[model samples]
Target: MAKGKEVRLTIVLECTTCVRNGGNVNKASTGISRYITQKNRHNTPNRLELRKFCPYCYKHTIHGEIKK
Candidate 1:
């Protein structure tokens, strides 16, 4: 019941637009637009990026991985 490390890791994806404008999910000024998902550390050593929907923006935008 032991292992070196987990292959999959939890990551947070935030909207690039909001991030640029210093908008965070916790901040009440804007609702929120982030996705919590798992990723394979081995497969994706680099930062991950995805197109997700942002209610604040009311459209799809690029969500990039940020420092945890």
Candidate 2:
């Protein structure tokens, strides 16, 4: 078997508040804000959650890693 290239994995962080409050007509949102970050597969093999700033929400919220 050929050796595979060792590449670091990256994930997207999305705001939970923006997704939940997206269905309202009166709400104003350009869209859900996302942040890209990298993680070491050997160090952490599970999903990651981070507190990030959401322009739409105007506050820091728990951003969860989402599948591509």
Which ten-residue region of model 1 has the weakest summed lDDT?
Answer: 23-32
Residue pair clashes in candidate 2: none
Name the runs in model 2 displaced over 4 angstroms: 1-7, 23-26
lDDT of 1: 0.83
lDDT of 1 at 48: 99
lDDT of 2 by residue, 1-68 (tens): 44334446877888887778772313655578789999777787798889999887788988989996
**Whole-model Cα lDDT per candidate?**
0.83, 0.78
- lDDT per residue for candidate 1 within 1-68, as digits (tens), equals 35648889889998998877777544556755789999999999999999999887778999998777
lDDT of 2 at 43: 80
Q: TM-score, each model?
A: 0.78, 0.77
Please state the error at residue 32 of candidate 1 in Å.
4.2
Q: Can you tell me which runs of candidate 1 are displaced by over 4 Å?
A: 1-4, 24-32
